[model samples]
Target: MSMSDLFVFGPLAEAATFEAVTVRPLDGVPARLPGYALTGAPDADPSLVVREGAVVEGLLVSPLPEAARARLDAYGVALGHETFKAQVDCEGGAPRMAEIGAPKAGASGPDWDVAEWRDGQGARWALMAGEIADHAPPLSPTSFARQKAMIAARASSRLRAAATPAPATLRHEARAGDVALRLDAPLSGEFFKLATMRLSHRRFDGGRAEALPREVLVGVDATLVLPYDPRRDRVLLVEQFRSGPARRGSTNPWSLEPVAGIVDAGETPEQAGLREAREEAGLQLDALIPIFEGYPSPGSSTDHFHCFLALADLPREESWRGGLDEEHEDLRLHAVPFDRAMSLAQTGEIDVIPMLAMMYWLAHHRARLRAEAGSDAA
Candidate 1:
């Protein structure tokens, strides 16, 4: 253990979050740092400005292990925090205080509450912090912050994945002991990430499989919403140039697909579905229906999708204009009869899997949806 005393003026002050990060009990005592004012982003790290006569209340932890202190320093560095010395009132006198970082300008708030943060975002953040620490190799400061920005979405993905029932293929592995994780390193890219790992698992023949190096693209979870107007017997679809199929040298890069978007930070799949409907097709979803949730390519990707069959009103005039211009989204909307959409799905005119799946689901449940709308109209 290294003899280092520290002052936490933010989320790190919470005992549970502190312990989770440092992997040791935090025997922190309430203390105050004088000559500083408290301010920072809510649910994130905090900052302190040196202000005469201003005092910030925080926790004072001392004599942390060298390793733990080093990890904490890395996290702070990644988060734009710089270390400074301050006087913390502990043991009825001034004690040496190692502050995390320098204060940020342009954005500041009132004193942060450890209790409120722990109550609201603590669970997911704790899990994400640990995971990020585990995979973080010393990256450039810019990369580090960018990676840090993704933790919320990562936490959401993990939580949603946890709530899902294990698939049939995964059931056997679930019944057995946890597969040995030879590696779990995450590599970040511009828009996605790659998790590299090597592992061995029990074989069906009661033998261990050889450890093999593997990599899978770690993707953000997304929402796919297919809009259907039961009263009009029409569905709204959008055509956009898909980069993936284009990269594969497909003759046609434009894909006919449903309204879709990456689940935004702190937003649920249902929220994303509705927002995407409005953004992509100029249609507002009234009520939603979940159709499917699955990994698009589990073998080599972590692209999980929450697919929904959205009930909406699609006006004929709105079919030509859609997609946010700010995102350079050149989307063209098409409003087709339900049968035409189904025929498109059958004839391979629809190239997107989510569109095909939703069309088939609508085919199966069209009668009931129509009847429900009729009753509501009556």
Candidate 2:
């Protein structure tokens, strides 16, 4: 019988990560694969691809028990990777055949840094992978790779929320122990994911309710910042075409909004707010005041929003366009006075929910902010 040996040149080479993901101790020997190199992008883990005259050192985990082999194969399939039989050198130049993933299209990065990723994002990924593996049966090796970023994005958001310290109210019955959460995969995905889940929770009146089957949209945790200059009584808003309104049959698809962006994995909402302010309005924000941390739609999605009120210096007249070209964002910055903004709000000219909320919040707090600025000036 042939041994089910696999050569791991990436994160799978780490003993802890391997065991955590594969559910087995990584018993292996130091080996080297000739004529191949390990490369990956910032968003992807290392992949071994053909690089002539390059010898990549790795670890060989072989003789996998049948069940474990099946799980491993499924993992590779879900990750959009494939294995090829290759010869590697081990102790005293002895050779062994190991399964390695074939390389794909990407600019080569540094040799895989497993520890760096571990300290930064390993635990969250481990949690996400384990959840996915539990429901991952088996799949064809030919399945295309997708949803790599989405998985990390969703995992990071979930982990962050878990670590966030918040006060609990008298609704103790709607607590962790009172609810059961389960994941049932609809399919492997890309930027968007639809998770079929069973949510059984305790009802009010000290009784248990029926377990409900639901779908969760695993969207990103994002930030939306409305840049304001309290002294100038002005706000910087961006005018851009939005798909949601267009799809909803709105005649005017070009909507006015504040600087906004998706909170990248491992990035704070504050960081996102500042970055978006620069990107969407070309203003370096001074102070970030968090308006709220909330879900866009809690009933059917995991999309989170960390709304902010960013204080910035807005020039009254400028010809500044913002947004990333790669993202196809053609935005115009509108530095409108606070009164005009309020008028727009009342007249329904500012229809986006987040923008409307920010305008109102500013309306309530504008006087205090200006007074504080005035004090600081003095």
Candidate 3:
């Protein structure tokens, strides 16, 4: 196989994790191998498989250098026994073959002739599937299938740009100087729907719009906080039964997290953080420390999360079981020293990424927190 013939189908294919995996672009014409098919769960589109049967099809491309190949293999856990096979084939001028996941029997190849597939939704889905699979550890068949479905839903979300659009064009655009004048022009191709598990026509500008340069309005959403009391050398975390994780095959669906709540349309992040501290944990925050502001996942989710570090005086005798009666939040609060929280984070007792990040932040900021606590007491 020559450099030009190779094509990656999933997250590796997207070129986002190329540096992490140590794979590089090959310079040559791309050629396709005939007889193989790509298979994945009905929902996820991240990774693709090249299976043997009628004829496995793929492009022959240049091989990765030894170091790059090693890195890629480690990242994909491709080492060990013969889980997959590598072969040589020819593309533009030379012949080459590559290693890909083993294919499943009787799996059907994608219907490329379909307008939506041709426009590149399949490729995008494959990319997303690869990313999710990469992060998640190997699971049982049932669990893997569920993960695949989640990946598909995430890929098909309308919040992200479709796979095959022109490189220079923005998915949604605003005037250069105006962040609020966002415009949604007509989309050029179809969109994949996670909920329906199918490709469908996507019409941009579906809503009534005046012109290219139009005002875009967005509401200020809510903020959630987990407060840590430095003077007492204790941190507060809330435990709640989370249906989302439960549905995703988590063994213990209930989770322990910092205080959190949404910001009303016009409320500020600080206001929302303090309010949640009171509502969920029955404590008032003395000071608020900014953590980070960013989207949880720009590729799949629309929700933006702004995190805060709240310092407060927690009452030891106060009941830990508190939640809004109307919302049906069955919450249990835990107050542990900073070191113990870090130990929990290290042991995987605390698995949520946000919670882990906050724990680490506290580890570094504990001294200042303690000094402030002393000043307040004085």
Best by TM-score: 1
Please identify which of the two predictions, 1 or 2, would achieve the higher TM-score against the true structure.
1
Scored against the true structure, residue 64 in model 2 reaches a CA lDDT of 76
Model 1 TM = 0.82
* lDDT by residue (tens digit), candidate 2, 1-378: 336578876666766557756779888899999988777653456777678898888787776777666566666666667666889998675798877764453676766556677777677767555534543554333332334445666778888888887676654524567888776553444466677878888777777766688888768788898888878878887889988799999999998887888887778889878888877766776669988778777898788888888888875744468888977889988888889888988998889887888789888999899988883532
Backbone clash pairs in model 1 (N, Cα, C under 3 Å; residues 3+ apart or in different chains), count: 2
lDDT (tens digit, per residue) of candidate 3 on 1-378:
223323443334434434334536534334444455544443223233444553333344356666555445444443121234444445445545555533233445453232344354554444443333233243334544444433443444322333223334756543242222222421111121121111122236544333333222121233658687667777887888887688999998888788887654224568778888888887766668898765555444444566998877765623368889987789988887767778889988887777888788777877877886784532
- What C-alpha lDDT do the candidate models reach, one value each? 0.74, 0.74, 0.53
- Which stretch of 10 consecutive residues in model 2 shows the poorest summed lDDT? 138-147
TM-score of each: 0.82, 0.75, 0.43
lDDT of 1 by residue, 164-223 (tens): 777676457465464675455545464577778886877777888767788887787999
- Total backbone collisions for each predicted model: 2, 0, 24
Residue pairs whose backbone atoms clash in candidate 2: none
What range of 10 consecutive residues in model 3 has the weakest lDDT sum? 187-196
